[model samples]
Target: MRRILAIGGGGFTTEKEPSLVDAYIHRLIDKPRPRICFVATPSGDNRAQIDKFYEAYGSLDCEVSNLPFFNGWGPNVIPYTDFKPHLLSQDAIFVGGGHLRSALAVWREWGLDVAMKEAWNRGVLLAGMSAGAMCWFETALGGPFEQGNYGVQRGLGLLPGACAAHYHNAHVSERRVNLLAEMHRGLIPSTLAIDDFAAVLFEDQQLVKTVSWASTSTAYRVRQQNGCVEEAPLTAVPLQESLIV
Candidate 1:
């Protein structure tokens, strides 16, 4: 009964979608008012980035608990048994953007990933944007480059295969697309390239739909195997009916 909302990172609050934040809040509380935990990790300590998230969700009247990562590490490694309980007590969990590799490493070190999967199994809401959304996949493109580290790094594996974030934006530079193509050339399955302001929602481990605030975003499905590469626009197919259940 887990509900997950993954956004590609844009149009968080717009005139036409005022309920974007409220929708998340309602998913957490299922009522007018509810208490929830806000797990945020901003890669850089920019006040603007921090305030933007606060303002977006704060307007919805949801109780937010800021849990910022320590030096890029999360609160999972504190050796406190109370960590799981504290997370479970909340109606939903919201993960903010940051370095995907660092976030997943910290989460795995402290069993945060395990806890989250357990919570999801128990019907807790799991939501994220950008890096947060990328971490859930089995593989992530450009993560090793972002961390300045070489070699393939494993992801949380919540979803099988690789995911490419900021698909259109990153493609502008070509480096990101090259990295993703390189990764796809390896053993990874077809990669999911998510454009900004778009998201693919999942429920019960099944993809439900793709949503966009401005309809400017797009997704690409790329597959390379045995020296043959194939790329196609993801929107041409229906996701809900095609997702493996």
Candidate 2:
């Protein structure tokens, strides 16, 4: 009963195609009005980005609330058991982009990930962009910064294997791909690289469809081990076609 929309990078507010966002919202909440919890790690420079997200969905009948983990003006808010009930009550949860490692670390320490999974199992809509999207996979590509090539940090594991975000964006360069390819060698799984403005939808624990801004995006199924690499374009394959069982 879990419905997840993992956007590559661009968010509903930034994209010209607002229909994609609208459609996902409606699907997540059957009613005309739904309560949405906006989870963000508000770094100093992300105020504009966070505000843009609110502006996009503010008009809807939904009640939107911002739950920021990193309070720039104050100390970090550790995740606590007291927040569990409030988290479960949300109809939809939208996560914002930021330092993926920091975000995951805080989420795990506070047990927000566990609480989110419980909410999803009880039928909640989970959506996000960039770093938010990366959390859905088992492993995520760290950053383009000096944090060193890639970090195989564990994710929510909602979907198995690893995912590379900002596929065609300048942040994820060819060098980053090469590093990921080398790191994934001998792993008993495949990796998916999703380009900006693209998204892959999952329902009932399977990939339902891949959507993007009309050829502006690409999806790749990459397999590698011991320096050998093989990759192919991911077609609009049905969820049933790639069952891992």
Candidate 3:
């Protein structure tokens, strides 16, 4: 089945980070020691984020490598990263978060967008947090990057409808409002939202599971009826604290 896991950001990328939810993401891969590739094309291949990805995954048994899209490192400003061969070889692709607009542009230009859909068809798990997670959906909340606020925009469409990450963060109230308002206004279809420390897993375009690191986090299915946008909570299975380490 084609699988996509949308994360709410902050899970297993640093020594001090929590891995409970991340562990769930890793286990989805059906390999003894999965070949996991990190794609930080979204974050402009930021060095620190790339370093953290290696550092965190390095502790695990999986073989890890990163696909960096650096200027001059490729044929043009978009980079010449050969998107398929390396992607087809991996068991999973973990993308990093950054400016979604620019990230999508670069990926489409490099053919990484098409390659990613191909990888998904071949049973490779496509997953990421925030902007990374947002990339796989047809529409997502959090963009335009103006005035330090959020808005909705088109996504890669690997998954249907819309999604918003960090749903419960107090700082993102405007984001939540914008998403619900957009839905209520009939600007987008039904949407999904996940708080930090949680993830909504989709298999074959169907939501198969919702899991959270701690009992406190959750996911939601939001839809518009008439002129109102409402939320129906999706209970997340709580992970044992032991799995966090």
The candidate that wins on TM-score is 3
What tens-digit string does per-residue lDDT give for candidate 3 at 1-245?
Answer: 78988887767643276476556666677558788888887778787777676666666677777777773232112224465887888888898777888888888887888999999999899999888888899987766533334466789998988888888877766667676666666776788888887888899999988888756788888898767788999978776632454
CA lDDT of every candidate: 0.60, 0.67, 0.76
- Error of model 1, residue 219, in angstroms: 2.7
By summed lDDT, the worst window of 10 consecutive residues in model 1 runs over 71-80
Order the candidates by TM-score, highest first. Answer: 3, 2, 1
> For candidate 2, lDDT tens digit of each residue in 1-245?
78887877776545654544445554557776677777775232265655665666665666666666554221222244476777688888888777788888788887888988998898888887778887888887656433344555688888877887777777547634555555465532467777776778789778877766545575677777566766666664332222323
Q: Which residue pairs show backbone clashes in model 2?
A: none
Off by over 4 Å in 2: 12-19, 42-45, 72-81, 144-148, 170-172, 179-189, 225-227, 236-245
Per-residue lDDT for 1-245 in model 1, tens only?
76776656653422244534335435435755454555554354234444554555566766555454453232222223456877776677777676777667777776888988887778777777777677777776534443233224576677777777666775455635565556554645577777766677678767766765444565667777567766666552232233323
- The collision pairs in model 1 are none
lDDT of candidate 2 at residue 143, scale 0 to 100: 64
Q: RMSD of each candidate?
A: 5.9, 5.7, 3.8
Error of 1 at 204 (Å): 1.6
Candidate 3 matches the true fold with a TM-score of: 0.88
Clashes of 2: 0
Candidate with more favorable, higher TM-score: 2 or 3:
3
